[model samples]
Target: MKKITGIFLSMLFAVTLAACGAKAPAGEDVKEETKTEDVNDEKMTEEKKDDKTSAKTDLNVFAAASMTESLEELKAVFEEENPDLNLVFNFDSSGTLKTQIAEGADCDVFISAAKKQMDELDPNSDTKDSDITIDPDTRFDLLENEVTLAVKEDSRKDIRSFDDIKTDKVETIALGNADVPVGQYSESLLKNMGVWD
Candidate 1:
């Protein structure tokens, strides 16, 4: 019985010693994960800094459909002088451009196709009342455009001038929107020519 008790105590002592030496693997794994996280965090911060440095002061310009070709040329010249300044253009009808500008789009400038809609905003070409996120006085008319009543190519209809559109069978005329500058000019031209009746 005494020998058996000694053996049992020796086994218990060995188990206690082994347990004292054995550390939880969980702690080591947690440390390794923390190291990995720190590395990722450092990498992400560096990437963010690089992006900030590379980012340019891009200026967004919305122009009229007719000014598409002309504006592209202007953009090239403007960008050359200001290399760090990027010029992005959105060319479309005046009505479309006005609505976008009114919605408070993040554009630096607006070159409206039609002065009528743009004039409704203001001389500066800003948005009307209703939550304007950008600067109010960021719009201006670069130049004026004239409108002419043009007929389709190779049409046999005798469309000599504005009066010709009023004649019979000239009903399906393709004109710009009323608020569009060209459309407004066209309307004025027809009214002055006494062909609106």
Candidate 2:
């Protein structure tokens, strides 16, 4: 976990530094030259053709619904930098995304809020379902989150914490469904506290 966190931080730092750099002034003429005369012109032409083909490719990213806001913000910056590649996002519960992938939905990238969903798709994991292929090398923890109890400001409930919710002082409670990562976490917490029935 520490290693993954470190890698994520490093990547975030690199992206921040790159985004801060100034771009070359507009209308400036830039010259290009071959590194060596031995370079094959045909190979170069073929590579350029491949690049053009790939430029029209659409990258489908399936991610948890909770990441919608942050991913949407990054989408604008990423699209501006790589105009040729279009990123199509399908945001939903992690479990739902996993089911989509299992059903052979087109996805170039998958970001799950919980490791459970990712594990189910990871070919290397013990919990993995057969037929799903995931590149383990590209997998890394992106962020950590906390679950908290919230109440309306005008509410008269005397809830102060998870334990408080177990008391009769609170009448009704709202929680995410089991398929949602937040819901799973909340359920786990409540179960651990001997409050979930």
- Model 2, residue 142: C-alpha shift (Å): 0.6
RMSD after Cα superposition, model 2: 13.3
Candidate 2, residues 1-197, lDDT tens digits: the string is 10111111111111111112334455542412232222456556666666554555467889899899999999979977876666778999999988887887777788999999888877779998747556778899999868989987887776678788877888877999998899999999989989888
TM-score list, all predictions: 0.57, 0.70
Off by more than 4 A, model 2: 1-55
Top candidate on TM-score is: 2
Which runs of model 1 end up more than 4 angstroms from their true locations? Answer: 1-53, 123-140, 166-172
| Ten residues in sequence with the least summed lDDT for candidate 2 | 1-10
In angstroms, the error of model 2 at 101 is 0.5
Tell me the TM-score of model 2: 0.70
